[model samples]
Target: MRRTKVDRRVKLHRELAEFIDMDLKMRGASVILCEIYGKWKGLREKEKDHEVVWPPMVIIMNTKLDKDDNDKWLGMGNPELLEYFNEYPAIGAHHSYGPQGHHGISVLIFESSTTGYFEAEGLG
Candidate 1:
């Protein structure tokens, strides 16, 4: 059977979710939610100097994460798993309080080229 875009997306989401879950579990954190969105290429145009462009991915979690935490999350991944993506995805975290007393954070895994904008906007 031929694999469709949706199939590929689902596979990617599952793989990433599992890796993140394990990483968080090792740190005593639990995953309340993990979502993977479609590929985003907006940063490619924003950064013209780089030859390789990474897609922007967003993950929602129940725990707060800082810059160091984000860095560790990326660093914890094994090379074999990391090679699946071909390039490193810049990870950033945003703390947010939802309605009805809900608390969690939104993590934006994007390209390093757009780090300045994300950090300046307090999204990273």
Candidate 2:
């Protein structure tokens, strides 16, 4: 049986979200999915590189993340799982400057998936 485009996407997101929640919790970092959008890449794209480098799926994070953290998260990816979703993992970070401190956050990336779902236990 074949799946429609929307069905494939929904399944992909469900699996991706579950994967993220499990890995983040294992790392002892609290994170929540704020939103997911298709038209925008992550916040740290270079001006000239604004073009969509990968697929349109973008996962917005509610908690701050660093490159190291993102690396760890990506490292947790399973090859079989990725193949199941037909997704290629890409990691991105957001750069923001503020008086309190700088906000350079890291995030997981995927080739195909829509919808953002986040869960957190304890975040500092």
Candidate 3:
């Protein structure tokens, strides 16, 4: 069972990498896949049992954007994009940053699930 779980994670990581590569190839975007793992901190005393948690499969995309138009690059006012992202997970957030000093506009994507804040933090 443990091996199965590990295998599944590996498969998922590969699939995501492939998908990102294909989807962004034409646009000249780069992706980095990483996981954020930590201990859970629950809202209530009963829920505060210390347990390891994996948040989500995080995808950080590096895409070129104009320095003069950060809002347009960040997709700050795009309701449709926001809605589409929200549909994929139990809970999630998206933000774009940069074109600062060295980096282009970076888009952060994550899968999230939550009961409360703690559950959100420990999104699996």
Cα displacement (angstroms), candidate 2, residue 56, comes to 17
Q: Which regions in candidate 3 have their CA more than 4 angstroms from the true location? A: 1-53, 60-65, 69-81, 84-87, 94-124
lDDT of 1 at 14: 92
Residues 32-90 of candidate 2: C-alpha lDDT, one tens digit per residue: 54432222344345564444433333333333333453333222123332343344343
Clashes of 2: 1
lDDT of 3 by residue, 1-124 (tens): 9999999989996885575446445445452323211232342347645653444433334543344443434333234334644634434444455445324333323433322223333432
User: Once model 3 is optimally superposed onto the true structure by TM-score, how far is the C-alpha of residue 97 displaced, in angstroms?
Assistant: 3.0
TM-scores for all candidates?
0.27, 0.28, 0.26
The numbered model that scores best in TM-score is 2
**Ranking of predictions according to TM-score:** 2, 1, 3
Better of 2 and 3 by lDDT: 3
C-alpha lDDT of candidate 1 relative to the true structure = 0.42
User: What digit string (tens of lDDT, one per residue) describes model 1 on residues 35-60?
Assistant: 21122233336664544324344444
- Global CA lDDT of candidate 3, please? 0.42
Query: Residue-pair clashes per candidate, as listed?
Result: 0, 1, 0
Error of 2 at 55 (Å): 16
